[model samples]
Target: MSAVNDTSFNSAVFLLTGIPGKEDVHLWISIPFFLIYVISIVGNSVIILIIKTDPSLHVPMYIFLSMLAVTDIGLSMSTMPSTLGIFLFNYKEISLDACFAQLFFVHLFSFSESSVLLLMSFDRFIAICNPLRYASILTLPRIAKMGLVCALRSVALVFPLPFLLKRFPYCHTNVLSHSYCLYQEVMKQACSDITVNSIYGFAVKLLAVGLDSLLIFLSYVMILTTVLSVTSSTESIKALNTCVSHVCAILFYYLPDIGLSVIHRFGNSSSNLPQVVMGYIYLLIPPLMNPVVYSMKNKHLRSRLFKAFCK
Candidate 1:
């Protein structure tokens, strides 16, 4: 890999776009964007608040749900500043330091969310497949440790990204597809050889998001196996019902990412609108829908939220 000591490369500025080729309609688009920001912030906030205040929700499932809510809040907030600037105020310039900082937090929360989802799936597996040992297996201390590990794992893995990029020179075009910075998106503009960055980035993705997804799927398979072995249909339905919200949460988190990947892989690169929409869905939909999904599926949370709002 080549390194450049040019001051201009180090001080390069990146330009972020809202929706390429759709700038004319951005004014109207800002309406939904603004609403999404508001809903995600308020919705996840309510979930966190509810989980904290309700003594009955002091269980492993609820604790994981609270962790998911916190991650959603961080993920949403990471993109909102630049996204709102692009859509509402037409602010497109982002310094290298600021861009890298945003990139760090964005990936940090994304990986953390993936980690929490995996843990939540494991929680379901234990609660369903090993009911008697559920409480014994996942005590409060263990749960806290799991949460800490998730946070630390994400931070440690993504911490090297910005510094890695900084070592390279960005002398090429600085335009990015989305308003926020991403690892692959930023590294593509570097003049130096990015072989190391690409390899390391893929390794991290494979180990964190890809590996976590595989394990979560295996957890559900085990859960299904246990559910089927139960004798009574009523009991089987009850066992599966508890997993609906979590399954929905998983779908919400991964489907858009898959779609965006497909779009980028096959769709015409000249057409940026599709990529932009899919990217927004990846970031916005989960945070907005997660609370709604959990509250509706969980009767206790639903009732508490109802009473909380009514008062």
Candidate 2:
């Protein structure tokens, strides 16, 4: 352990960690990560393009899907640089400012994604429960306003994090546990009292991700109730089926996220390997899987994709 008073805030450099005990195979490991990045970028881009170019798909649901695709791209890009740098080029050292910037964007996209998912659930709820007024209630201008509010909320919540973390003096080992800079991971390295940081981080997670998750759950509960009230079982099945893609999106996004949180809170240093692996899964899988899920489940998207590629 270094002396607490020895390190200055401006001079701090954090070493981003790749997979533990896999140093000899980093080049090999980079192969799959590179593939994941390529697929994620290409897949999400295709989804966004399909939604944007098709006037028929400009409804609130597809528009929210586009927002999700954009956010997934942002999330993937945030970690890709440092991750590939470390594995392919042995570039592990990240300056404090660079790390903070990366952390901010990562969280921004993450929270934004959460907000988009919540909005998507609302879209579904309205479409299923009140199909008559869905159009009037979810006008294009109103959807745009909802998106702007979500973005602004995410920015306002995450904007203070870098500055807050910057105020703390770090004398502990500056090696980050994952290939990217995360708020909790960075705060752990600070030698000073991180009470405020901890509180703020917890609050942000609670208010942003936590609240989003809770509302999403409630939305689905109401959806299910409404779904069950349908006198025709076939209609009920059809209505629920429409949500299949979104449900998969939610599972992919939140399951690993919850697993990572559990591991971080309960696991010790021995859990580093799982932590890193889960971190990669949490970040990479959703972007890569979302397009495939949506295209396969959504008839409109699937048809559009087939027409574009088959032609």
lDDT of each: 0.91, 0.93
Q: For residues 1-311, what per-residue lDDT tens digits would candidate 2 score against the true structure?
A: 35544556568799999998888899999999999999999999999988989899999999999999999999999999999999998899999999999999999998998999999999999999999999999999999999999999999999999999888887788998899999988999987889898899989989998999999999999999999998999999999999999999999989988888888878787659888988998999999999899989999889999999997
User: For residues 63-86, could you state the per-residue lDDT of candidate 1 as single tens digits?
Assistant: 999999999999999999999999
Question: Which residue pairs of candidate 2 clash?
Answer: none
Worst 10 residues of 1 by lDDT: 1-10
Which prediction has the highest lDDT against the true structure?
A: 2
Candidate 1: lDDT of 305? 96
Cα lDDT for residue 198, model 2? 88
In model 1, what is the error at residue 24, expressed in angstroms?
A: 1.9
